[model samples]
Target chain A: MGLQRGVCVIGAGMTRFHHKIHKDKSGRELFVEAALEAMESVDKGIERKDIQALFVGYFTPSLYEHQGHIGPLVTDWMGLTPITGWRTETACASSIAAFMTGVLAIASGWYDVVMVGGVEKMTALPTEGVTDALSVAADDDYEIPAGATFPGLYALLAQAYFKKYNMTWEDLQAIPIKNHHNGALNPKAQFQEEIMDIAKRIGQREGVTFKDPLDFLKSKYNRVIAWPLRLFDCCPISDGAAVAILAAEDVAKKFTDTPIRVAGIGFGTDTLALHDRISLTSFASAVFASRQAYKMAGIEPKDVDVVEVHDCFSIAEVIATEDLGLFERGEGLKAAVEGRTALDGDRPVNPSGGLKCKGHPVGATGAAMIHELWKQLRGEAGKRQIPDAEIGLAHNVGGTGASCGVVILRR
Target chain B: MVSGSAAQFLTKTFYDKLKEGKLIGCRCKKCNFVMIPPRLLCKECGSKDLELVEFKGTGTLETFTVIHVPPMRLKNVAPYVTGIVKLDEGPMIMGRIVGVDPNKPEELRMGQRMQMEVIEEDGKPVLAFKPVS
Candidate 1:
């Protein structure tokens, strides 16, 4: 079955995802900033009174900001009070769920227009506090009791992949390097400098020299957070928000002459712990969710021109490409190593530099992906634009492989 | 037949058995699927008809990683090895790997036989595994 009444994205906007830049801003302010940008993005301009409702995806507000009841809180902040508003949570995929909820509400003929977005004020806490807060998404009784951190959970997947494919840790470095190159071109990204540039700058200050990015990565500067997964291999914590405006398909043109149609929406969940799954080489939730989305969209993996998958870690991107059927199993890493997943590659992935360099504000990541896709499809993604991008997809996952959401959009 | 209903297959029960020098799991009476850290329902067939079962404390190392940065509670035990072991009883579980050098991960081999051992961390009983030469 398909959407009863179609929904289209008329406008989207996001703040530059970074750690230090948004240090003083709270989640409410970050969301309002993104919402204002989204309002400005509307071609014909829409008013707050015209919007029917609101749906937000903000994970760990209580832990990060020591606040709850953020749905009405953000609604009031945006001056859209008295309109029904609420929040959704699925760990990192929270906003995708919110976006899908907005889609369903419109498709069900309940509302003609709605605003969907995600926000996270992660920098409010220290690194360790953030880590503890995020780990709550996992199986607390099982996974966390075994001393598994986020990096360590992914490290296990990398280890299994290396053993099955006979690859090495050095093979995964291409991901961070390529993402950094893409991030350099994205003003909204957290780390805007290339890996080699950062390496050289650090080397000059530390009284050390390196031959290249790989050499610098192998040095002590990139200390191992988990064996086979170093500092650069992990995404840094950042604070940001993303907002998108959705309109019923028939009335989409009232706000914009050109609107991106929501082609497909799919979400799936698996066991929380990795040990309970059939295999560690791939995320079954992503596979299941993407398959459903492709079927509903009536398209094949080859039809996707550009994509933004969750790259919370380098190896995660590798597994995501495979799970989405963009690359064959055990071939994702090789694709990255060969520049096939670069901005100018045959199968371009994460044109926003991914969560790796774009920065992972956790809750904001899912909608931020949609923000990138909207820019790409509209020929508005300035430097990292994929030429003539027609069909775009976004894959978002929660803790480990427990939850996933796959969304497809077309111009 | 193992005593107690599916209610006995709780988290505290599993850890208590480990503290008593016994490694226990649960088997679905309907599907015969075994799972570690005992659960009330079977993941394979959605059957609550489960019974407690004892393991021989042996398995094969499936995958592993050395955690150089651990959670706050595990801060004192940084740079420790954690892995998933495919137990002989047909279910896999995650635990710490001891009796080996955490820094030298290249020395470890997949498919190597392992023996389960109970260890204390943060004043709580935690499962651990050691390589069986």
Candidate 2:
């Protein structure tokens, strides 16, 4: 909305998301790896000189890696020297913001070609340290003072949603099961095994067994992180990177044979603290952003044959689908149970296993969602690909929806 | 005290007041819109003519959650209950829900009358609520 020039993603790439796989690697290293892959992905070939700007998203490098000025740092690491660059931050949606910023840069005719990506080396921090770092996304004063943990915040949303819709905890488990199933197909996903496989493997190790995935999930082994939200319900702390190359629409084909058009992109915001929201059950920011994006794209939610949503927690996926108008408020809770969001389902959501399975490296998440959509549109997505997907959407929420960004891509 | 902007200082004043058994809100002189965790300027009308006003400290529980795994600073006090309370003064605020079984969340219901109180944590006053049964 900020710029008039049309833009499209020419290439996209990412590293395998994980908790410890990138232990020997830094955020910059992961970023370069994804960037190099993206460079190699352009069908017509691309060089470092072709990229005129750099937009990166990293949640907290100063805290995660004791590093700052990550924009030029990563630019230099990628061998794209002397180009103007800046880092974007909006909690987990940082990378989506970067991608939108890149769109603006290209659309403004300020730059012909630009690189947008997100990286977060979150595994370096201990659990609580990670929690503390992420909390900065929420209201620092009221939320932290009230002991509102990230999980606790979403848990509160889950409770409110359940109360409003009369849904049970069992109805929500379908999300992880479906996401894990999709994740099992993704080579780059953090958790590549189904809940059944994980249950068996971990059970064998702990000398405990279960009747099924649901039984295993119900067990204390998947103990509550927050009431009504168990361990499996929360996304893991991961270290990874995702990058997308964007070019003006006219020049897009020069780089890639099948450029995914940036159809509609919009950003929205709400009060930082969950308490400040008018309703706990929905994020008005997400709804506003999605509506703006739809109007820009000139396509309804029905046109989105596939989508990748910010599922930092399970309840989020439901809220997002509802907020984005993909499903009615109460219907989103049952979408998973009804198998409507499956990869083979009519409207596949998060075919890349979403943030829950693909891994949520905060800053990398938004870009990764776009990466999945790109693959789906190009028919590059192998197992999790939705059939004949023409348009797709990525919804990224910052904190408990304090900041939100939506991007719709069309093939 | 967490050090930051003057706006944050004004917010910290809200906590300082809580420690002294007071519930304060910043009321705009123009529109009379109140910001509970006080603000430097009125969000509604952008009026700088704002003053702290005392609230009845009584409200209804809007929603709640029992934190099973808290952050590092709160790890010692794991399994604390947090909730959003709609203040009778017309703003919602977040605080710990004390004097209730955090595990038995069923015991708490939405719209239940709640009263604000302060509990000491790390020598700082933390805001909390208790159901008025």
Which candidate's lDDT is highest?
A: 1
In angstroms, the error of model 1 at B131 is 1.3
DockQ of candidates 1 onward, in order?
0.85, 0.78
lDDT of 2 by residue, B20-128 (tens): 9888777777898977877888878988877777888899998888888888888888888899999998999999999898778788888899998889888988889
Model 1, A219: alpha-carbon shift in Å?
Answer: 1.0
lDDT of 1 by residue, A1-411 (tens): 789899999999999999999888999999999999999999999999978889999889999999999899999999989998999999999999889999999999999999999999998988788889999888888888788889999999999998898888899999999999999999899999999999999998999989999999999999999888999999999999999999999999999999999999999999999999998989889999999999989999999999999999899999999999999999999999999999889999999999999999988999999999999999999999999999999999998879999999999
Candidate 1 chain A, poorest ten consecutive residues by summed lDDT:
A138-147
Tell me each candidate's TM-score: 0.98, 0.96
Residue A16 miss distance in model 2 (angstroms): 0.6
Distance from true location, Cα of A15 in model 1, Å: 1.1
Residue A234 of model 1 has an lDDT of 96
- Tens-digit lDDT track for model 2 on A143-245? 8888988998999899889889999889999999999999999999999999999999989999998999999999988999888899999999999999999
- iRMS values in order, in angstroms? 0.8, 0.8
